[model samples]
Target: MLTITLAQADGSWENPEQIRGAVAAFVKAHLPGNAAQAHVAVQGPAPGLRFPACRQMRMGFFGYSNPYGNQTVAVTCTTPSAWTIYIPVQLVMNQAVVVAARPLGAGTLLAADDLSIIRRNASNLAGSAVVDPQLAVGQVLRFGVAAGQPILASMLDAPEVVHAGQEITLIAEGDGVRISTIAKAMENGRPGQTILVRNSSSGKVIRGTVDQAGAVLVPF
Candidate 1:
């Protein structure tokens, strides 16, 4: 076995480099994805920081360490059982995400012309930042958004495709056959929303999903 020796401070024993290396290894193993760059920043304890050095040092986290942002890491001496210290680390993660191209009001539909892609520092952005333009486009805003703002998942929703009291064509398909009927929507709904509709011919209410063409699909 090859024994690697780490350079230690004179008489005092503080292997800050070892701690940094350990944290780096841990971050590298946990970082997700190949597109974004992951970086872990850790500084050794202050020069005056005094503690008994142990042959075995272990690094632990206070909670789950985020892939990005500041974290408190625990460095402990397992063999000596003398002392433990916490180190503050900052992780910088940069990634690409979609942003609004123009100011949009609530209930505004997001189209391809309303979105742009750019590289950004995601540290300050919410966890719901939309990464794909396709996910943001064709969705309606739950709240107003400023131009150049990062589009968050919580800010968008599917716009209502069917409105209450509106007449819509209902299609029923079964066993490779299709049937069409007239129905009146009882409630507003989006493309995938299920709502009750009254069939004009049968005069009976049935459950169906709103379709893109202002129609409803009811399965037998």
Candidate 2:
């Protein structure tokens, strides 16, 4: 067991348990996400270590340490004597995140059954994992994911509405005049994405934005 001592103005010693509790509370209050999910383990001062009586005390995180995982807290004493000590802390926070239920191939359209929600250590995650099933469902996978692998936001993409070699209507409007032409898409594109199209009528290549209706809109 570790013991830390703090002295009040009356010369009464503060309980070491209170000091540990205070440090845990301080870390929890500053942690991001749900504080209730965080578990903090604060290591007390070294054995037989003693600090002089202090009328005023302040505590803060030392250096560039993050709020979670292994960290250090600096305790500063002010008043009759001024001193500082570093306390080690361990923090773990579990959060629900989406993961693949089975090995899914690249380009596969995700469905509700393809994903599962599980509690994982947020501090150890490599990237921001998807949390909502609705956000993953109907989305196309950019790369293959193994079973039980956490699904990151970068791994999913919007379904392509226009495919290469598909015939689509290209429309351009300016000065109250609107023109439409049939064109072939040069590449796959999702809604709102710019793609190259070859106009069948003029035999010319043009860039246009794919619309929700699957048509390409050329800027004037």
Candidate No. with top TM-score: 1
lDDT of 1 at 143: 89
Q: Tally clashes: model 2.
A: 0
Which number leads on lDDT? 2
Per-residue lDDT tens digits for candidate 1, residues 133-217, read: 9998889999898988999899988889899999999999888888998899999999888999999999999999888777999
C-alpha RMSD in Å of predicted model 1 compared with the true structure: 4.3
Candidate 2 lDDT, tens digit per residue, 151-182? 99889888999999999999998889999989
TM-score of 2: 0.71
Worst 10-residue stretch by lDDT in candidate 1? 1-10
Candidate 1, superposed: residue stretches over 4 Å from native: 1-10, 34-36, 43-47, 169-180, 211-220
Worst 10 residues of 2 by lDDT: 1-10
Candidate 2 global lDDT: 0.81
Clashes of 1: 0
